[model samples]
Every structure is written in structure tokens, then in C-alpha cells.
Target: MGKDLILQAGRRTITMETAAVAALEARVDDSFHRACELMLGCSGRVIVSGMGKSGHIGRKIAATLASTGTPSFFVHPGEASHGDLGMITRHDVVIAISNSGSSAEVLTLLPLLKRLGIPLISMTGKTDSPLAQSADVNLDIAVETEACPLNLAPTSSTTVTLVMGDALAVALLEARGFTAEDFAFSHPGGALGRQLLLKVADVMHAGEELPQVSPETPLSKALLEMTSKGFGMTTIVDSNGQLLGVFTDGDLRRVIDQKLELDTATMEQVMSRRPKTVSAHTLAAEALRIMEDNKITALVVEDPEHHPIGLLHMHDVLRAGVI
Candidate 1:
């Protein structure tokens, strides 16, 4: 009705849900452990099913589990009855979500799951409901009250269900020793995947694109190389093409401050020696960290013998979405 009343309602809802989530910590007891064990031991995919709002949470839980190394997918309880039940297999495990724990559509699938000897796990608000009683392991998702002022809508209960799903996914992820690389594989199209999977060689400018000059080269020539390569820097190499140092825009400023003749200056005299370097095999994400920590824009990608093979620019990493 009024602005104060609307704000008060929103705050009250958040406060109630926050308390409900806190209560979930205590419920993560033996039952939670057993559920994780069951899912971990599943030889096939973990099948998740529910109805209405619970179904929405079930789909997210399945997605989280699948991304974190646990193979899973969501199936609507209503659809499962209409030939979709064929999707479930004897080797798989089932996680059913229903606040009342008596959803008839979900209950109908129990007999079939039992016939196949599939492990049954239930997240329910009522421990004594049929679904809970039938499950091999029951996770208590019961909340004290709904966040709705009427105490009728599935508000606090749904939030608790989603959080419980996250806890289960994270726990199983750690138990399975799932790594960031593993997650990247599951999400190859995202920025996070690029960060974790891309190597310096994959994003670095190599071959003809690398800006390099010999130590004996004039500062003017090195500056031209830096400009042509668009890297804002050029590597100084020895006769054998081994990295000796680097000349950058920053060096140009210093040379100007000293009133040196750009034409008379040599790469060896003006270059910053022993510049920071990264191997081509290094992770692009790690290379970004190196640049940020050292306050540098570029890194010389070197071979084992310190030969300049490529140039890794911060822009290159960002372009590849490593950040």
C-alpha cells in the first residue's frame, strides 16, 4: 500500500529466509552425508525430478551437479510418467524434491525406481511423508515458516531447497577432487572456461607477430618495431636470438627525460635487462596475475634456453576473455 509498508515487507522476507538458510546448517547431518555417498557411487547419471517450484530448483540442482563433475539431468515428474521415465536407468540414482513429500506424480515413479533397484534420495519438508519414508536417504528441507505474509506461498521453503542443492553439489565436487580445469571443460563457452583453459601460447603473439630486435639495434629501430607490432614493447635478443632485454614506451620516456639522442641510443644501452618472462605453456590466467602484480603490460614468452618466441600482452589475455 505505502512505500514504508513495501520496504518493510521486503526486509521481513529477507530476514525470514536468512534464518531458514542458517537452520539448514544443523540439518546437514548423517542423512546429507549418505545422500552424497549415494550420488558419488552412482554409476550412471543422477536423475532429478520434482513438480512446480520444486521442479525449478531441481533443474538448477541438476545443472550445478553436472557442471561440478557429477553427471546429472532434470526430468519433470509429470513428463517422467509419460514415456520420459525411460530416461532413468537401473545404474542411475534419483533425487526427488517435494515440500509435502507426497507429490502423486513423484510418488508414482517410486515403484519403478524400486523395481530397478535405483538409489532414492528425497528433499522434503515433511519427514513422515510418503516420499521421505520411501527414500533410501531423506534430506530435511523443512523450514519454520514461509516468507509470505500469508505463510502459504512457497517462499522460504524454495530458497532453502536451492541452497541445500548448492551445498550438496559443492560437497560432492570437493569429494571427487573436481578441479577448475574440469569445470572449464563443462563450460567451454564462458569467460571462466577461457581463463582456466587458455595457455599463454594460445593467446600470445608468436612467429612474425612477435616484435624483436637485436641488442645492437638502434633505439629508433626498436621503437619502430614496437609500433609496427602494436605491442607497445619490443624484445632485445642476442645474435643467437636469445632474449637479452626489452625496450618499451616507458623506456622511451626515461630516455627523453635524460635528453639522450634516440638515433644514437642502442637497444643494449636503453633496454630493461632481465625483463619478466613467461613460458608459452603457462596459463593465460596466471600470466594476467603476473602482469597485474608486477605492474607491467607485457611479458616476454621465452623457450627453455631464454630465446624470445612470443609476446604476451595484457590486451591479448583480455581479448581471449581470460579476465
Candidate 2:
């Protein structure tokens, strides 16, 4: 086949699925609201079950729901028949997905689910199908046609099902007032977690690692502290440990431009006064933004009292994966 023909085929598939999703948007009725209400009111997790391609979509939906503050997980319909059905409790809610709403594996569990008195939310293409008719709430995910050329494979139908799952997850997320910090708690090892949950104090150089010098200290001594600490900068403070200013490599270059002798100049005379400072409790990502916006590489981490307690450099942010 020609390359252009392959590209055209891909475009047609996307167009078909896009139309299918747009149609699903119009069909979001009271049943969708009832499903969300049931899920929100569930004392146990949302148990999602499906067969074949629908199972794959259910797994993703369950994961999204769990990460967005709704406790949920997927159970394969085949596995549910074998023993996994015990995982479902009456306090939980079940969302069963089937393109035709007549999968034998899914239908087999209906009687048991009803016996348990658990709520069932059905997602299917056929409103009159066995699974939909047996469910407590039926969500129609019908598509006019399949994206597959033969109209046999589940394409547009599955896309609509996935979108409907997202709609339910986001509605529950908003109803629960889930915040990014809560999402970070569920994904502590992910990049978003590092950006939102990691604080500057967690990564900044503190105590002996903090490079500091007295305002009256000679610039040469401050340079020694900068070299020893390997932070490329030094914070200048008073006897009370109050921040007086900061001296960085850029300040060194400026001093060199003025032809001033490092041994004779005091830090207070050569340092950049009132250099950018951030609280130790500030988020590392916010610190990174302040550094990027000011085009600076280092910031002094202070307490609420304005006393310099630590130092943060760009490398620390990079090491923490906040950059």
C-alpha cells in the first residue's frame, strides 16, 4: 500500500473516533449523574470489570479514578468468575463495560452482584442489552459506526466508553475537592509529585553545607567560602544572622570589571544587596520558577524571621528532578 494511503487511513480513524466522542457528550443525561452519585456515596472502592478490549479501557478508568481521589481498581471479568468476585462488597460500586452489553463472562456475574445488593453501573452500546437492562444505572456509549474498515473491531465504541469513564472520574474528582497535592500523594515517585510536594528545605544546603560570610568579611574570604561550599555563591549576614546581601560569581565578575582588590573590599561593599530569597517551606518548583524568571542560579533560603538558614542552587533543583 502507498504511504499516503496509510496516512489517510489513520486520519479517517481519528475522525471517526472524534465524532463518536462528540456524540457521547450529547448523551450525558441523568443516568451519568446517578452513576457519579452512587460512586461518590460508595463506602468501598469502585470495582471496574470488563472483557477483552473493554477490560483494557476499564483498567485505565480505574487507575484514573484512584489517582483522582476516588478509590477504584479493575477486576477482569474472567478472573471475577474464578474467585475475584469476592473482592466486590455491597458497600462498593461496580462499573461493567461491554461494547455489545452481552458478554457472557460479564452477564454471568449479574445474579451474584444483585444477590450481594451492590450497585451496578453499566456502560454499553446497547441500551436494551441484558447487562444494561439488569444494571441499576445504564450509561449508553453507542457509536454510529466503527472506525475499522470492516466495522467489526471495537474502535469508536471503545473510544466513547473511555471518554465516558473520564467524565465520571473528573466529576467525582471535583465533587471530592481533590487537589494537586492530593494527586501528588498518590503519585509521590512521579514528576508531578516532585514538583508539587517536594519543598526547598528538603533539597537545600543547610547547617555546615550552607556557605555564609559576615558582611564585614573581606571579599577574598567570602570567595574561599564559596569555593569550599561549591555553591558558586555565598550569603552575607550580620552578627545576628540577619541577611545583609549575597555575593555570586556574577558579583565577582563585576568586581573584576571595577578593578577592585578582593582583599581590600568587604562583602557589604561588593555583594548584591537584598538578593532573591525564598522561604525554606516553599515548593522546589516555585523556587525554580523564581530563579528562572530572575535569571539567577542561587537563592537564599530563610525562615519566617528573615534570617538566612540555608542556600539553594540550580543544581540542587536539577538533582531533585524539579527542573
Candidate 3:
């Protein structure tokens, strides 16, 4: 009834759930390895099915598996009886989740799945349950007790189930040698996609939008180019269009402090030479790292011939969500 009592109860729940999850570490033995091996070798997608709270966790597990290189989807046990059983194939692997491991909807499909010759993987708190006995590989997700005070709510059980699901998915992912670039393909709308898939050329200002001036150009003229291009910096290039140096607002401050006349001083005399340059094909994420490490706000994108082709500013990466 009191605030301290409620807080204490909450802490107990967390401790119970944490212990339940930790117990699963020992269960990740031969059975877990066999399950991962089966899922990895499956030619068809993994069909995850469950009932009640287990179903919710199953759906999330399926999603995690799908996004992390394993082809998978959730199939409600109830619907599997109502024509959705047609979704299963001989090549597919089925992951059935149930704390009791004897849900009627799931049990009804055992015969059909067996007849179809599909491998069945069961996750249950009771390894002695019917589902476990029928499965090709049984993943024991047994927990000591529920986090609920009355020992009725599916608190710790569901948490353990979810963690076991993650273990299986991650094992398969690592076994497949799935890379970040491969993950980006599955999530083109997320930040990871932008980080791994977007190239410097994709976000950099190119052609007429590039702020550049010849090395012999006056500092005042370079300032005009920087302002016109709105990049706050201008790249200095040789007559043949090869990069020579860069002049930024920082350089302008130095010139002013030393009493150099902007109109009369050439960029070659005041510019920072050997400016940081990146390839047009380089990933935007790598470019962002380079800028952050050097404390610069912009970089020049160059072609194979060392010609300045584009300019990438930190703001560009920010707008593209690469940051």
C-alpha cells in the first residue's frame, strides 16, 4: 500500500525475471546448438507459432530473426488450424512456443507437421511436455518461478522465452556471417541503412553546388564562393582542377588576426594544405567519423583522378540521419 512497499515489490519482480533469464544460460547447450544448426540449414523461412503471451513473444522473435538475416515469420496457432497450415512446407523449420507445451491449437498441428516431414523445434518450460517429446529439438526455457506475487502471471516465463528466442536468432545470424551491409538491405528506412548504404556521392554537393576556387584566387573571392555555395568553406584547386588546399571560416579568422588584407592575399598563402579528402564511393558513416575525429565540419569528395567532384558537410550527414 505504501510507496516503499510498491518499489520493493517492483525490485523483487526485476530480480526474479533477471534470475530466470540467467538460468537459461546453462540450458544453451547441445539442444540450442542443434536448433541453430537446423534453422541455419533450413531452405524455407522459419515459421514461429504460439498462443497467448507466448504468441506476442513469438512474433517479436520472428521479427528479430527476419531482420537479422534469418528468413522467418509468425504464424498464429489458432489460424494454422483454419487454413493457415498451408503456409508450412517440408523445407521450412517450425518454432512452437508454449510455457505448458500443450496448447490445443499447437498440438493439433503436430500430426500435420510430422506428416509433411517439416522439422519441429519446441520451446517450453517443461521438457517433459508433449510438445517437447514430439519436437526434433527441444529448447528448455524453464524458469524457477513467476515474477508475479501470486505466481500466476506469465512474467518471468515470458522474459526467459524472449531471451531464448534472441539467443537462437543471434546464433544463426553469426553462423551465417551476416554483415552490416547485408542488414542495411533489409532495413532501408532505418538509421543502420543510412549508415551502411549511403555513399559520400549520394549526399555530397556536386557540380555547380561545390564550393571551390583556384589556389591563386584571392581570399576575398574564396569567401564569396563559400557564401554562394553555403558550405562555410571553399576548396582550393590547381589550374588542372586537382585539389591544392582548403580555406574555411577558421582561415579567415587567422588572416584577420594577423592583419592580412583579404582582397590582396592569395588562398595559396593562407589555405590549409593537404585538405582531408574522401572517395565518392566511400560510405557516409566513415566520412562522418573522419570529420568528427579531426574536428572539421566538411570534406572534399574526389574522383579516382584526384579531381574534386563533391563536398560533404557534417550537416549533410545529420540531415540524412547517418548521425
Best by TM-score: 2
> Which lDDT values do the candidates have, in the order given?
0.95, 0.93, 0.93
Displacement of the residue 257 alpha carbon in candidate 2, Å: 1.7
lDDT (Cα, tens digit) per residue for candidate 1, span 1-323: 99999999999999999999999999999999999999999899999999999999999999999999999999999999999999999999999999999999999999999998999999999999999999999999999999998989999999999999999999999999999899999989988889889999998888999998998898888888988999899998888989889988999999999999989889989999889999999999999999999999999999999999999999989988887
Cα error of candidate 2 at position 226, Å: 2.2
What CA root-mean-square deviation does each model show from the true structure? Answer: 1.8, 1.4, 1.7
Once superposed on the true structure, which residue ranges of model 3 sit more than 4 Å away at CA?
none
Clash number by candidate, in order: 0, 0, 0
Error of 3 at 1 (Å): 1.2
Q: After superposition, how far is residue 258 of candidate 2 from its true place, in Å?
A: 1.5
Candidate 2 lDDT by residue in tens digits, 57-85: 99999999999999999999999999999
* Cand. 2 Cα-lDDT: 0.93
Candidate 3's displacement at residue 255, Å, is 1.8
* Runs in model 1 lying further than 4 Å from the true structure: 262-264
